[model samples]
Target: MNNQDFPERTCLICKDKKDKKDLFRLVKTGEDKYAFDEKQKEQSRGYYICKSHECLKRLSKHKKIKVDTDDLIKMLNLLKKGEKDYLNILRAMKNSQTLSFGMNMVLEEIEHTHFLVLAEDISEKNERKLLLRAKELNITYVYCGNKQQLGEIFGKDEVSVIGVKNKQIARGLIN
Candidate 1:
C-alpha cells in the first residue's frame, strides 16, 4: 500500500485531518477512564490528537473530555513516554545484532545501513560527513539525545552515531 492508502483522522483539539499514523491516539476504556494508545490498536473509542505540545496543552484544557486534571496528566505522561520506547527499540536492535555504531564502523558499513541515528552532541565534522554520506545514499537520519545517552544503549562510554540495518525497524523508528 502507498501513503494515500492510509486512513486519516481528525485531531480533537485542532480539528485538522491527518494520517492516522501521524497522530497520537487516546482510547476511552471506561466511563471516565482514558488510555494512551501508542500503537493505535486499542479496541475502544479512540480520539486522535496532533503529535505536538500545543495540541496536548489544548487537550488538557478541553472541558468536553470530562476527564479530571490528574487523570488527564497521567494519560498525557503515557503519550510522552516516547524516549523510553526509542531506547527499547535500540536495545532490541542491539540484541538482534542489527545495529552498527562508532564513526568508523558506521561509515564502513554505510552501504548496508537502512537508517542513521546521530547524537545531538556529535562533533560538527562527524555530523557533516555522516549527513553527506546519508544524503548521497538516500538513507534517512535523525538526531536524538546526546553522545553519553546513546552510548549507554550500546554499553559504551560514548557513541556519536548509530546505523540501523533492518529496514522494517528503521521505518518504524522514522515514523
Candidate 2:
C-alpha cells in the first residue's frame, strides 16, 4: 500500500500528523476517564498521541486530556509492558517449532525464514553476515535485547540470532 492509503491522525500534544498505526489511541471511557486502546478498536471518543517519550510527557499538560501526572506514568508503563509482550510471542513461536535460533541453524534455513531478530550485542562478524543475507533475501530484521535475554526465550545459554518462519508472526514482530 502507498502512503496515501494509510489514514492519519494529529497528536494532541505535538500536533504532528502521523499514520494512524504510528500513534497511540486513548479512548474516553467515561467522564474525565481515559484508557489506552492498544488495538485501536475501542468504540468511543478517541485522542491520538505520538508514541514518543517527549510527546507522552507533554500530553499530561494538555488541558483537554485531564490526565494527572500519575496516570500518565501508568500509561507509559502500560505501553512499555505492551512492547515487552513480544517475548511471549517469541515463546509461542518456539513452542510451535516455527523459530530457528543461533547462527548455524538460521543460516541453514535462511530460505524459509520470514523475519530475523538479532541480539543487540551480537558479534560484528555474525551481525554483518546475517544482515547481508537478510538484505539479499529481502527479509525484515530487527535488533532486540542482548544475547542472554534472547537465549532465555529458547532455553539456551546465549543466542545471537533467531529466524521466524511464520509469515503472520514475522509481520507482527516487524510491525
Candidate 3:
C-alpha cells in the first residue's frame, strides 16, 4: 500500500509518527498484562513503539505496565535461531560429499535436489529460475541471509546458491 493508505502510529518512546507496520505493537489483553503483537491483529487497547530495541527497552520500563524482558529476548532468539540452523546445515553440507554449491552446479542436478538454499543477494533472474525449478521438482527451498554469510559457510567470499543432496539434512533444514 502507498504511504497515504498506511495507518500512521506514533511511537511512545520516540514520539515519531511511522507506518503501523513499521513499528512494534504492545496490546493490553488483561488487567496489567501486555503482549507483544507481532502480527498487529490483536483485539485490545494497543500502544506502538519504534522497532528499535532501545525504544522497546524504554517502553518496557513504563510504570503501570508489566513487560517481560524475556519476551523481547525470545523474539530475538527466534530470529537468531533461523540463521544458526542454516549455518549448521551448511556446516553439515561441508563435510558431506552430496552438497553442491554455485547456481550452475545446483541447476545441473535440480531434478534430484532435496533442499535448495538461495542467498537473498542473488540476481533476480537466477533466483526466479532456481525457485521455479525447485517448485516444479517439489524440492524444499529457502531464501535466506546474505551472499556473504552463505559464502562464509562454504569457505568462499560469497555464494548465491547451495543444494543439499542429503535428504535427512535437507529435511532438517526445511523443518
Candidate 4:
C-alpha cells in the first residue's frame, strides 16, 4: 500500500473527507477526557474536525461541551479591566495634571511616560515611531484593544496612542 491508499478522516462538522494530517484530531483520552491532538502523536480513539472556528463551534454544539480557552478568556478579561483602568487613570490624571495624548504631546513627554498604551488599529508607521520612543525612553508599554475602544475611553473620534504619566496606574495596566 502506498500513501494514496492511506485512510482519510471525515470532519465531524462539515462531513467532508480530508487527509488525517490536514484535519484536527481530537482523541478520547479517558472516560470523559477529550482533547484536540495538536501534536498528532496521541494513541487513542480519535475523531477529526476541520480547522475553522465554525467547525469547532459546531462540534461543541453537537457534543454539548464548551471548548476550553482559559488563557484567552483570562487575557480578554484583563484587557477589559485595562480599558476601565485606563479611563480611571485619565480622570485621575486630570486632577493631578499629568496626562497627555496626541502623537506629538506623547512623543514630547515620552521621558515622563510611566506606561504607554498603543491601539492595535494604529498605522504601522505610527506604531513603529511610538514603540521606538517608548523603548528609547525606557517607558513600560503595552498594546491592548483597538482604536475605537481607546477612542471611547479618551472621548475622541479615534486615538492611536495614549501615554500614562501616573506610575501606579501604569504598573497596574502592565501587570
Measured by lDDT, the strongest candidate is 2
Candidate 4 on 5-72: residue-level lDDT in tens? 87688886699887775467777655544566666777876677764444654665565433446422
| lDDT agreement with native, every candidate | 0.80, 0.81, 0.75, 0.68
Clashing pairs in 4: none
Tell me the tens digit of each residue's lDDT in model 1 across 4-122. 57678898878989877657788876664556676767787778887655577777777665445664576557545765577778977787878999999999999999999888689
For 16-89, candidate 2 gives per-residue lDDT tens digits of: 89778667888886676666776778788678887665677677666667665665777678656654686668
* TM-score (all chains, Cα) for each model: 0.56, 0.57, 0.58, 0.52
C-alpha root-mean-square deviation, candidate 4: 12.6
lDDT of 3 by residue, 1-175 (tens): 6755768988867799977755668887677667777776777766876655455566667776666777677544544566677777687669677788888888998877799888867899989899789878988776666788888887889889889888887877766
Candidate 4 residue spans exceeding 4 A from truth = 1-82, 91-95
Ranking by TM-score: 3, 2, 1, 4
Candidate closer to the true structure by TM-score (higher is better), 1 or 2: 2
Best by TM-score: 3
Misplaced by over 4 Å in model 1 are 1-80
> How many clashing pairs does model 4 include?
0
Candidate 3 stretches with Cα past 4 Å from truth are 1-77
